[model samples]
Target: MIIRENSMLSRRHLLSLLAAGTAMGGAAGLTTGVAHAQAAIPDITLGDPSAPVTVVEYASYTCPHCAEFHSDTFKDFKAEYIDTGKVHFIYREVFFDRYGLWAAMIARCAGPENYFGIADLIYAGQGDWARQGDPAAVADSLKRIGLQAGLSQGQVDACLQDAAMAEGLYGWYQENATRDGVRSTPSFLINGDMHSGNMNLSQIGQLVDEASS
Candidate 1:
């Protein structure tokens, strides 16, 4: 799903989506311009910055296939490449819905140091949290995940209530996904080549090896 540039996310929608377990009463206006906001959002990455293979993965937090990839394939892949500095891995969040966006916000709230760990937790519990009743319930589940990741309640609430950050993430995702021709979750840009769907370790390794060559 391609989110167009003109479709700006409103603060009211963000607040409502995450109002269940948060103190959004202190939510502020979207004062920051989209361009500036996008610039402020960082692309948290892993592995060696100068590794031979550069793999950019576009995945939605609410995607079941993405969850499967994270749970089953990612550990082996990371052990073989990321931890050993053989691959420069970049994980970009694709927001197919407000739920996915909220999840990304929570994972990001943990900061870069704990970003991947929080993301793993989100994926590990996707079946439960993503389907936890309504929008408010989902928000509550995500808040619990944030807490489990050692994030303070105040930090999670603040991150979710940041209208500017939310807008920026939306704009940034739209721009990146559109530019990279990402039409689905669990998509990969292996050395500038696009690959889609859930990929196993062997498939990824083959592509990474080919890219390295």
Candidate 2:
């Protein structure tokens, strides 16, 4: 597997800058920190105990394109592939900032059963949460969202502060992204082949067909 060096600035440095009120505001600071923590982990998979095809996605919650893909194309894909046991879908987090990572952790903390539900909400609400402009406020909003999804405030807070878990996530993303030649958000790996950008259902279906064959 090939690995590529991350070109984005480190999450810690971005958070420090935000805290200092240099590049970003308080909201941005919180988002950056949380997103960094999320980045320090790897992708999580769901669907199909014994599928022939595996589809992995490297995505960021803050990415508009990723959100669009989720909104427009994912339902069909899930219905056809994920739900029917033809494909095992893995969702990996890639952070563009702290907010993105924080969102990822919140989704993960919901546990595997609820991970996709929370992820859908995050992607759907990405515009509102990411642009809220107050780190504490954004965190609180996310906390509330998590609570609605059955996560306690304590659970969300604990997950957010999990440095070791965050590091593991980052390491996993780093390695996977490298191996899959992913340089941008919404990149995909279909049975070890790489495809980038937001793809239509037909395009993905074709890839799935190829993989299965």
lDDT of each: 0.79, 0.73
Where in model 1 is the C-alpha error above 4 Å? 1-39
- Which candidate leads the pack in TM-score? 1
Error of 2 at 150 (Å): 1.7
Per-residue lDDT of 199 in model 1: 86
Alpha-carbon shift of residue 115 in model 1 (angstroms): 0.4
* TM-score, per-candidate, Cα-based: 0.85, 0.80
RMSD of each: 4.1, 5.3
> What lDDT does candidate 1 reach at residue 135?
64
Clashing pairs in 1: none
Q: Compared with the true structure, what per-residue lDDT tens digits does model 1 show for residues 133-158?
A: 57667777888999999999988776
In candidate 2, what are the lDDT values of residues 1-213, reduced to their tens digit? 112235454746644533543222223323334444544343477688579999988888888889988999998999989999999998888765667767877899967778888888888888888888877677777777788888887787766665555555655655766667678878888888888888889988999999999
| TM-score between model 2 and native | 0.80
